[model samples]
Target: MRQSACINTLIRRRDNASEPKITDSISPKEASPTLSRLGFLVALGFLRLTSVLPLRLLHWIGGGLGWLFAVIPNRSAATTRRNIAACFPALSSAEQESLARQSLKGMVCTGLEMGKAWILPIEGTLAQVTEVEGLAALQAAAKAGEGVILLAPHLGNWEIFGYFVCEGIASNFMYQPPKNPQMDALLRGVRAKSGIQLAPTNRKGVAILLGALQKGELVGVLPDQVPTDEGGVYADFFGESAFTMTLTSRLAQRGTPRVFCGFAQRLPKGKGFKVIVHEADAGIYDKDLGASAAAINRSVERCVRLAPEQYQWEYKRFRRQPDDSEFY
Candidate 1:
């Protein structure tokens, strides 16, 4: 099998460097579009306003907005309905609709919760986490100096989960940059507060992640997103054939790092979040690429099952089918 035919950049580093240079990736000169600048400012202002509100109030507003989303005829609601129907065939129509509504509500809450993550102090954010369920495994992995790959799915508030994990551990993760340069800068600034390395989703980013793993540091990936052609393979997710990223499997082949699945469970009425981590399926380490990808999907499914309603069902996960059929 061909290895990394899609990864495009080379990884480079100076001797004895702890962090890679990131400021050159996207500079202000490259993102001077007038419209994008306006949108970025508006977005930042909105986030600041939301950050001052209580968690309960934000969730209440999110619930109201979610109802509006479900009531209106839009692509997001339609996609959520189709995904729920395909994944949970056992549910009645009423049940599916209810689940779809709940999922939409959860997504809205997730957006508002980003205010707390981006604007609030690190201690303020950590204070909201009610508990961390699976710490012993991670601590053990760190002590062994074998590194760890944290497969964080799109369940609940992923930003909260990321912040919690990287707070204490020297971690690295790849993130797709936003279209607007200002927004991307703001995101990078907020996430940098924890002193973790953030790489843009590209060849350079993948290389950084690999380097971190080699150094016995934590690496995180959102294993649920649909990768581009040549970057993923079709895998059975919730009984449906979904395109799954092979990066997780490719990285696992490099070393004996422990792989764990994790997510932050949103508490009722925005009480806070609960972080849960568990061991990944053994099949993730299998030699077969397809099998490894499927195993990664199964790991994600297990995490989403912890709080199904919070999964980002609105995403077009099944958009690229194996037989070239359009799902969304």
Candidate 2:
């Protein structure tokens, strides 16, 4: 009887409160943008700090973050755990737990190293690339005087992949400019520091890419990013149909550009990053879009296999899907 009475009183209160109000407590347009700018400044400051800090110090901080995330019972983390679980089910519970721990550590370390990756010398970072194979293959592909397309997956220190191409291969790339204008200038400056031009992800950006191709240049891009709903097609990613950006395929089909698969595998400890390179697999340029996508994904798979620990396993890879599926 007491519970029923409480419920009735709550319902009455909610009904009365349904009427809206107009007050200063609601609008925050001016403050919102200002706060965002403040966040950008803080984020850049931290990036700068992390770049100079010793790798050991970053790992110590990263370990604490990993431990905290490992214990959390949450959505994004849990979903990533599930995806990883599917990839290596043969492991014991303890092994899976270790991977989860490492995933967080890898993520934190990457975050810590972003500033160095963006601004550090290419000669310094690419030293970790122990070996370079298939230079002749790359040269052969470029013989047609067409622009080369380099696709980096989420398998490694992707930041350095752009740097390697820009410095080693003389490539340029299109970038999604940061939403915050303050950071936009910073990113544009760093990404282009090696003399590679950064194209915007807009109509003009496509024109820039095509023009580069016509002039026999190289273009690098990360093909694993989620696309706008209107433009994406469902592609199989690690045994799941993920909404992958079709930009890679569309570009290859458009210009028949030679596509080389590359990724910067993050090394153990603070040893820096490595760039793994491979020729696109067969069927990547097939008339069948599905075949092409699968071939491209297979190429990415090879990059991932080069160093599984460095892969970005914690990313919201399968967040979007067709229909209303809660399996994620």
All-Cα superposition RMSD per candidate: 9.3, 10.1
Q: Model 2: per-residue lDDT, tens digit, 96-145?
A: 77887777666666666665665456565444354455545666666657
Would you list the C-alpha lDDT of every candidate in the order shown? 0.80, 0.66
- Leading candidate by TM-score: 1
Local error of candidate 2 at residue 227 (angstroms): 1.5
Error of 1 at 52 (Å): 1.9
Give lDDT tens digits, candidate 1, residues 222-282: 8988888888989999999999999999999898889999888989876888999999999
RMSD of 2: 10.1
**Worst 10-residue stretch by lDDT in candidate 1?**
1-10
